[model samples]
Structure formats: structure tokens, C-alpha cells
Target: MPVLDLTDLPAACPPGTAWLGLDLGEKTIGVAASDTSRMIASPLTLIRKTKFTDDAQALFRLMDERKVSALIVGLPLNMDGSEGPRAQSCRAFARNLDRIRPVNVAFQDERLSTSAVERFLIEDLDLNRKRRAGVIDRTAAAWILQGALDRLRP
Candidate 1:
């Protein structure tokens, strides 16, 4: 399936399945998942970047295990809400991900998502640098997913 507009995800969502969230970084892909009710999101895992085929297969396996049918991928937009190179890369990932198998994907504006996650970690969790580095990506993925879920809620 081609990537759908972000707003189209809820309507296109299939029953009895959950949504997966992705925060794509240069070296890793952060992952999160929504509840079947689509109300809450939790950080799931991280996928270290490797071959595209390897990454896709790992992601697909997680989706299969978790009954996930759609992806809400973070779109790193400029502060002015413009698509930049990073955003374009995410769009490409979505397109390429679809080629392996059918997957509905949508972009959620991810301005400051990583920084916001960092702030929360520092202020609330107070985790040390190494610990923060270990969990930041997946935690950011949860933040991204929660933002989408909040907006998508009726």
C-alpha cells in the first residue's frame, strides 16, 4: 500500500489490530505500539540500522507479532512546517517499506520530538547520559506515537 495522508490513517485502519509508530534515525529506528483500543502507546524496541532489507524484515516481524497493520512514522518537519531532507528520507522509507508487503503509513509532524524526549528524560527521569542514550530513541518513538494517538482520538 502507498503511504496515506496522516489524517487518513484512522479511517483506513483495520479492526482488531494496532498501530505502530516509528522514529527513524540515522543509525536506529525507534519503535512504539498502540493498544488495540488505540488509546495508549508504549515504547517497544529499537532496530539498529543495517541493510534496508534486514531492517524491513525486522520491522515486519514485529508488526506480525503485535497485530500491527499500519505505521505512524515521524515526519521531521522544519519549524515552519516545511518538508526538508530528513522528512523526504522518511517519506522514502515509507514508500520502500510498502514494496515488501502491504502497509499503510502516515506521517506525523515530529518537530522537536527528540529534544522533547530528552527534556522529559532529564527533568523527570533524571537518567544519566549513557542510560538516556540507551533508551532515548525508543522513548521518542513513544512520545511520537502518543502525540498521534492524542490527536486521532475522537
Candidate 2:
């Protein structure tokens, strides 16, 4: 399967199918999932980085358990909106994942996603640095997924 645009995602999957959101960092992969109705996105879990096979297996396991029908991955675009190494890595990861599972994949613009999540955790939630670090990845994944879900709203 190819990486799809947000507008195309609903067409790719059946209604009431769950969607998995991923924020792939160097050391961890943050996971989030939407309700079967595609209305709410919530932080799920974090996968500590390991070998590619292990990471993929872990992601696949989550998808299977969650009954995920599509994947929405955060793409870390440069400030100028140019594709940088991180963005390329995200695209590569999506392509590789597709090769393994052949599921619908989509990318959401993730500029400042992490920073926004950290700020929210600190200011609104009043979380300390250590606590923030532990949850920031999955929170950012939810933020990213929420953005895409909002776009899908009728």
C-alpha cells in the first residue's frame, strides 16, 4: 500500500475501523489510536526502539490487538516546510511498514507537535520534566492523530 493523503484515508478503510497513530522518535515509537468512529484519538503506549524487525513486530502486534485498519504517522517537516532527514526517515518507515503489513498509511504535518505536547503537559497538566518525558511521545502521537481526525470531521 502507498502512503495516502488525509483526505484519502477514509476511503481506504471501512467505516468503524480503528486507526493507529505513530510518532516515531529515535529511541521510541509513540502510539495512539482513534475510536472506531474516528472521533477521538487517545494515547496508547510507547515502544522502546530496538532492531527493525523487533520494532515492526511490536507495531504489528499493537495494530492487531487494536484492530487498526490504517496508520497515520507524524511527519516532522522542517520549519520552511522542506523535507528534511527526519521527514525522509518517516516516509521510509511508512514504506517499510507497508511492505510488511500492506495497510493504508497517511502522514500528518507534525511541525511543533512535540513542543506543543510538552508545553501542554507542563502548563495545563502541571507535569514535571521526568513525568513529561515519560509521556510526551504518546501524547504527541495523540496530538498528531487528533489533528488528522479533525480534518476528517464532517
Candidate 3:
């Protein structure tokens, strides 16, 4: 397995194995997981930034523990759909992870994902700024994963 195109992910993964989603930020990596049936995605955890080896190890542990067979990483595309430094960083991270784990890794356009999650937290959940900051990335990862799952659904 390798870093895969989004169009190829559904076919690459085995049935009943969940998908993991990642939001790779400068300070932290937000994580989410899909259901075994791939119908829903939920916020999982936040990994504080350290060395890349440490981060990949933590991610690998989670994948093994949760039976994740594929990954859908959020690509921070610009509003105009251009790749930025953040997107390149994300791709690099995915490439490194692929080398270590050999799992199907795909990217989803994550423009406005954080803002959308913030809006939901404020308007629907009524979370304050501090609370939103604590969980926003992971929640955004869920939002990104859910979008991909929706597209993957038959």
C-alpha cells in the first residue's frame, strides 16, 4: 500500500476495517475515525507535535488498536483550490507515514473545515472560545472524514 488517490481509497480498503482521518497542524495532529461500516466518523484524539518518529508511532498504535485499514488526511487547500505550504506539509507527512505503515492514505480538501466546525460549536453546541479551541481540530477532522465517507457511500 501507498499514498493513494481519493478515488481509489474505497476499493483499496477491506470491508469492515475503519478509516482514520487526520488534520495535520503545526502544533498538533487532530484525529478521527470512521465506523467499521464506514457510515459515520467521530473525533478521536489530538496528538501533540513532537518528533516525526514519535508522531508516527502514536498514529500507528492507534491504527493497530482501532483496526484502521486506511487513512484520509485533511489537505489544507487554499480557498482558490491551490496547494499551499500547509498542503505540501500534509502530503509530506502522509508520504512518510506511507513509508512506515504501507497503508492506503488519501487527502481530502479541508478548506474551511476548521471554521465550519467552529460555527457548529458556537451556534449549535454553544461552546465557548476556549472550549472550542481545545477540540476544534479533532472535530474538524471528523467533519472532513464525514465528507469523504458521504462521497464513498453507495
Best by lDDT: 2
Q: What TM-score would every model get versus the actual structure?
A: 0.97, 0.98, 0.97
lDDT: worst 10-residue window of model 3: 1-10
Separate clash counts for every candidate:
0, 0, 0
Model 2 CA RMSD to the hidden true structure, in angstroms:
0.7
For model 2, the superposed segments whose C-alpha errors exceed 4 Å read none
Q: Tens-digit lDDT track for model 3 on 1-154?
A: 7777888998888889999999888999999999999999999999999999999999999999999999899999999999989999999998888787787899899999998999999999999999998999999999999999998777
How many collisions between residues are there in candidate 1? Answer: 0
Best by TM-score: 2
Q: Name the better of 2 and 3 by lDDT.
A: 2
Give me the runs in candidate 3 sitting further than 4 Å from their true place: none
